[model samples]
Target: MASFLALLPRSLTTFLYAVAALLRFYGNIDTTPISKIPLTILQWSFITFILGTAALLANLGLEWNAGNRSRNREIEERNRADQERQRAVSRARIQNRFFLLQTRHQLTPSPETRTALADFLSFLQEYGE
Candidate 1:
């Protein structure tokens, strides 16, 4: 069986492996003429090698998938943190503008500055909410 699989194209190897797996599960190799119930140590080793190769590839694929998922999650977390920082900085800028306008109005006592302060206070109230 191994020799037959080796003779086949590499592209067909995966399909053959699938077929081999189905046969292993349901075909009952013990009943087949090719299979001996009391398998020799060499025969057992060959079977183990065949199945182990498939298992190793499956394990590697699962690990690779897990790595990608973790990396993507980390990137998303970093992006969220950056956006939060940007929002905090924006709020600080708004607060600074409000304070500066209020101080200017207090010192000058002018109509324009008073109106500007009023408008900024309203903006601050709306944005802070």
Candidate 2:
């Protein structure tokens, strides 16, 4: 029952197409077969139209999904690049702080300044990883 309902729209569409084809091509005198089998122009048109429309729609869906996947991949790459830039900026700040501490220690020769420089260096190492 669920599956039948799922196919209801397609079945209804096919029925409507059949009705339209019958109305348009009713009382045709050319009943000649296009091939070995007895197939009229109206019948061929109906068959081709149905199959062609299905194929075209399927192709369009595939192309749409492919385009979305490509767009998502580009966004992910941009995010990664932004994160790398942020990390580079943070490392530069740490290096600057370490240099300032080193300069102060050189001038005053204090244990506190030395400890601070060591701490900044350790932080830079951790952040780089």
Candidate 3:
């Protein structure tokens, strides 16, 4: 399919030449151009309309892509901020739990409370790193 598409232009050109030759054989086909043919108003208007439409579509596509990029960046930033807030909340909860355990241990000393405090400190050390 790719090779066929690549050869399409050459094939069309050869076909046009064959057609021109056949036409020339049937009549006295003048090859010389007497003057440059000026385009009619409608033809010029059609060309200008096509060019303007193409430019407008191209500009719209560019703007759409730019808007999508900015929107994606904003969404990513929002996601990152949400994740940070969650982490901060988790850290605060852990600290509050640790403080509560420490206060209980200070009021009434217990082996279980000491072990739990030690475990919490170890977890904080590992997580902070």
Candidate 4:
């Protein structure tokens, strides 16, 4: 109710102005040549056509803006999801490397492989895995 009342002043002002405009438009017309009802109808139709065009353009602008903003947000979300997937792959790679090093150490036991295992272990610890 409060919100409805807030619009009352502007609505009343617009209605009174429209009425005054219509009276002034019809006043100078020589109704002796044309009937009053048809002349009134034509003016009303013209006003409504102009208003409709304005509303259509306004809605089109709103829709275009919404689509552009939505596309940007969608791209951002796709990039964030792609980053998360890459992080998961990195963690898995670290785990797989640790597993392979352990299995090889149990088999051949080469010193070079031992050094590689130490380096790999350090990498794994720093990898946030």
Winning candidate number (lDDT): 2
Model 4: CA > 4 A from native: 1-41, 105-129
For model 3 the local lDDT of residue 113 reads 68
How far residue 129's Cα lies from its native spot in candidate 2, in Å, is: 44
Please provide, for model 1 over 6-125, each residue's C-alpha lDDT reduced to its tens digit, 9 standing for 90 to 100: 334443445546655655565443433345576643444456558656665665676687699999999999999999999999999999999999786676978887887899999999
Which scores greater on TM-score, model 1 or model 4? 1
Residues 25-65 of candidate 3 have per-residue lDDT tens digits of 53344434324756543444444455555555655666687
- Give Cα distance to truth, residue 40, candidate 2, Å: 3.1
Model 3's lDDT to the true fold? 0.66
How big is the positional error of residue 19 in model 4, measured in Å on the Cα after superposition? 14
For candidate 4, lDDT tens digit of each residue in 1-129?
966654554455455456556755775663332354555544554655565555556556666876999999999999999999999999999999999988866667788877877888899999947
Better-scoring candidate (TM-score), 1 or 3: 3
Pairs of residues at least 3 apart in sequence or in different chains that clash in candidate 3: none
Q: Give the TM-score of candidate 4.
A: 0.45
Clashing pairs in 1: none
Candidate 2, which ten residues in sequence have the lowest lDDT sum?
A: 18-27
